[model samples]
Target chain A: MYVDVILNQPASRDYRVYIDQLETLHFDTKVLIVTNTTVASLHLETLQKKIEAKELYSVILPDGEQYKNMQSLNLILNACFEHRLDRKSLLIAFGGGVIGDMTGFAASIYQRGIDFIQIPTTLLSQVDASVGGKTGINNSYGKNLIGSFWQPRAVYCESVFLKTLPKREFSAGVAEMIKMAVTFDKAFFEWLETHDLEDEAHLKEAIAKSIAIKARVVALDETEQGIRAVLNYGHTFAHVIENQTHYTTFLHGEAVAIGMVMANILAQKLTFLNADEALRIVTLLEHYDLPTHYRIENVEAFYDAFFLDKKSEHAVIKFILAQGIGGYEISRNIPKEVVLEALKEANA
Target chain B: MYVDVILNQPASRDYRVYIDQLETLHFDTKVLIVTNTTVASLHLETLQKKIEAKELYSVILPDGEQYKNMQSLNLILNACFEHRLDRKSLLIAFGGGVIGDMTGFAASIYQRGIDFIQIPTTLLSQVDASVGGKTGINNSYGKNLIGSFWQPRAVYCESVFLKTLPKREFSAGVAEMIKMAVTFDKAFFEWLETHDLEDEAHLKEAIAKSIAIKARVVALDETEQGIRAVLNYGHTFAHVIENQTHYTTFLHGEAVAIGMVMANILAQKLTFLNADEALRIVTLLEHYDLPTHYRIENVEAFYDAFFLDKKSEHAVIKFILAQGIGGYEISRNIPKEVVLEALKEANA
Candidate 1:
């Protein structure tokens, strides 16, 4: 299946996203596949056999989010230099979000910008990271603290890559899918309340539905200048939790799962989402085996870090509050005391 | 005088360039001035006083082309992190091409992208570097081998900064002005042949003319996918010379001066530019006290490195040959033997 993403900006670009099985990938230009050791071990042979190019090379990085730093990013860029890859070369992000983010960031800077494609292997990456033009790596200060908006020439997402994903990671991916339905499509959220996602066919449909909503949001606000903030419905709180835990405690989707719950509570306090509506979303997260609660070390510290968000302006931090499932609003008027109260409510 | 450069690409960007005296700059956003020790020592105080911002900071890197690498670029990114510079912050490139290139590259990847204004402080930067959206850092591989296209919010080209530039640097700046004139504006090239650039009025008019041509070419081909290659008319050979010398032998504009002479020699060989026209251009460089000749250490070695250019496609090197002056073409028709002959001619 092919989906189109329109970046209605200067030097207007539109790219096709292929989601199905992997086909023989070949390029007439220099090509580099940036992958991690884990992914390489699992699928390198199959990928190597199926892909052909004028100059195809691979740079293997160690797996895990900890390695997503400037040192690791340089591995990809240095490979480009060592191979003498020019503007005509292409970079293929062949792992998960970590690889996709780093590869896209590298392509964005390689010779002032080159072409790249996203082959997101993980469910989280397929539905979120690879779809948006947002690409970055974590810094000592926080997650994705460094990056830019560089859309890929195309994306090839194969569901087969998820067959080997561990149960915890698999569940984490579903959390993001649930987040999408809750934020944009009420009927999809309602369907999730009764559907059996364990079925392969059902899961694929859910994934596509999630991607379609994300594609719509990105098309409207490629730079997150406005409506795109709604896509970060749970990311503001999620980034903080990841930062506090050094981004090593929970998978991104897990943190975001709990973040959505906290947002629901915040919305209830403002009378935007009633108690029943909030619980319905939490119950759905539970059904998906996603975390719906989190504990804060210090509410004030989290509050201060909130203002440092890439989405924030001046001292005002915009919050995405749920009006009801599939309905949300971005507001900067939430009282600090209300946020502090919500933190206490979310305490373990 | 104000010049406008319209980037008609994805997320099209347009900004005005102020090309006259220094004016007080006041921005409500957090701002950081990324400069080198030499340029900062010369104008930091004056700049600090004239620029009013919510929060202002400075990162002083050592001055030189050799320092334009990833390490120096990180200094700018690190300062941004230290200040907790959110997306709303602005970075001011307050030096020559090195500063402008590094600062603009930093802003392009800082939080995946942020706002930056170019405060180009040298004549070369005003008429050349700051006019285009090209920003990058030199890696061990080559000159500007790493970077991306990131347009600045605005470029403030205060010719007043030229007062402190040493005589050699002053001459280097004039070489770039001559390159712009020779490549895109024949009238401007003719004006340079008889004009006294030492006169401030004449210099300002010359600088404005160089920028106008650049602004027009950039508007049409922001990515260098077309006419933009004409702007790199002299850069191909210049980059190799700088690479062989480890970017320490001469200023960028000085190397470009010698490179233009080589380009003219090749153009004459192809009958694209007659002997008189090439000599007229050479005489203008001499009038500006710019080097019009360079000796290649190894002609064959230089020829091999030419294929490594960001402009080369499928091992085919494109040459921008002058058809008289202000008229050019991007051609991949030059044979290896012909290029070798021209290289032998450039040998001392």
Candidate 2:
């Protein structure tokens, strides 16, 4: 039987950044912040000031996508061990998706399971990764193929952290915002069409709307069994690009930006989406300076990667094709010819 | 809101246990069996006979408690990467508790998560580890410091594997059996008093009873929020003892044997149990020749280890003390002095 896991809403907190002060979010024990060098340089002090606990410690790891593997997981576990962090000690995932996923996973595994709070500092993380409780590290097999549906005790999405984010990074974050809009909220989709993401007010509103959309989807389908897959609208194609490029070429949002465009073309070809709607998506993505297409090196090799993806399994590719801008249908046993045609359009 | 996650039991399957039949469980995908050299030598041929996957492989790790750590976890993860186990493949954990814990943990993080089955080859593992979804490796801080509550897709328990087990190992499994009876089933506990564990019929009944108790408890409290902590009737002291002895000095069950004896004394002192009931427990453990005590070289150091235990936090240690043979209570805020006194008596 499926379970409806509650998603706790973030509480109100003043937007401030420092190296380390003492405030009480009211946890009963020590708190350990799991982050890396990059985040430590920028916001660790700020986070330290905001969180008050009986005891507080920081474990800084070497930062990079390359380190998002089992070795990094070991490092996180080691920190928890060394600190004697028990089931009572709270783990704060203080970086972006990689840190959030790894730290949440560490908390999930530590002492069988423990409480963890998400203090997501990246746009991609605040709107997407922080909500799902999808904790895992990437392996050679594929991204997020191994993970647990372990949610956090609370999520502190302080938009203040976005101040240091690069323009491209902010736009990449917008990609997921747009995906959520396209798959679930047409009003939000329309809002994105008219607003410039560079406007911080508009971006905050978009992030909130996007997260709410994701929250609704997740509340209905916590385990990604049905409606939750809508969140993966562009991710299927995006994961291949991310893997093929060794996850270095495209910021996750950038890959999804191109992936969304490719998916739109496939939707249009199959009459799942109108040409005008597809064009509108492409136009908006281009406005953000997000790549809308990529060169395909080898068709079959690229096609082979889809089978390796966690989404498509048992030789059945379950494609999330749009029924225009606001609706999606998960199609299964999708023929290779149709997928190949979509791949060609993606390359084009 | 508290969410109860219940696992629906799948129909059991009959599996062939041969040292050479590992391939039959796979379907054209890579298969990796994370086991130690001891189990590999004893039953690899039997496993090999069943494995007919596209790629069949094994990584025989160093056999023993010392190897159940982060370095070994890294080794297991590295083997997965080196062997190139894909997303669709499977990992079979084919040893006792250490193997099961490490392998289950490795699978949990291998790609985020992967499918794995437990082929528990020891009585301790077959009756205990195989039933709970508790998968983890130990750390310097304490046992099972890093792990997940990840349930296996299936568990294959073949009583035939026990034939090769040493006498001490067989007795260790019975300790868990005794634990199950003491906590949940009073009638079962009384029956155990008369039945010899060496008899095959009684052994099978005991194993089934132990599994059923664990399965019920786990089904009710998968993440150990409430009543499930009662299952750790002796683990509070067991972890401390195991930690002090460096885990190599005794099998987990043997430590638990001594721990149960210590807990009984504590229970009697707390007025929750009578000495008569405690003595009956001592007599049963003695019948199996399981160690009932260990000298505490340093009482302060042993006490320090309890704080490092995953179950302990701050100054409070949660102890599972029995009211009598069939009644249990999870006592938190257990004073160190009380625990020390029990330890002193057990040692004497």
Candidate that scores best on DockQ? 1
Tell me the tens digit of each residue's lDDT in model 1 across A11-80. Answer: 4467877888568977888899999999999987777777788888999999999899999989999999
Provide the overall lDDT of each model, using Cα atoms, as 2-decimal numbers: 0.85, 0.78
TM-score (0 to 1) of chain B for each candidate: 0.95, 0.89
The model with the greatest TM-score is 1
The residue-by-residue lDDT of candidate 2 on B24-129, one tens digit each, is 5655778888888988888888877877887888888998887888788878877877776756678889899999988888888766677787888998997788
List candidate 2 segments past 4 Å from native: A1-24, A243-249, A297-318, A331-348, B1-32, B47-59, B74-90, B298-305, B308-310, B329-344
Q: What DockQ does each prediction reach against the true complex?
A: 0.68, 0.43
- The C-alpha TM-scores of every prediction are 0.96, 0.86
Q: lDDT tens string, model 2, A251-329?
A: 9999998888877777777788998898888888888898888788887888788877643545667778777787897
Question: Candidate 1, after superposition: displacement of residue B235 in Å?
Answer: 2.6
True-contact fraction in model 2 equals: 0.72
Pick out the ten consecutive residues of candidate 2 chain A with the lowest summed lDDT: A12-21
Model 1, B1-348: lDDT tens digits are 888887775444688888774578888888999999998889999899988999999999999888998899989999998887888899999999999999999998888788898988888888889978899988666678788888999998887899998888888889888888887889998888878999998988888888888999998888888898888888888988877887678788889988989988888888899989988988888887888777787899999988766546667787877888888867786988998998898774
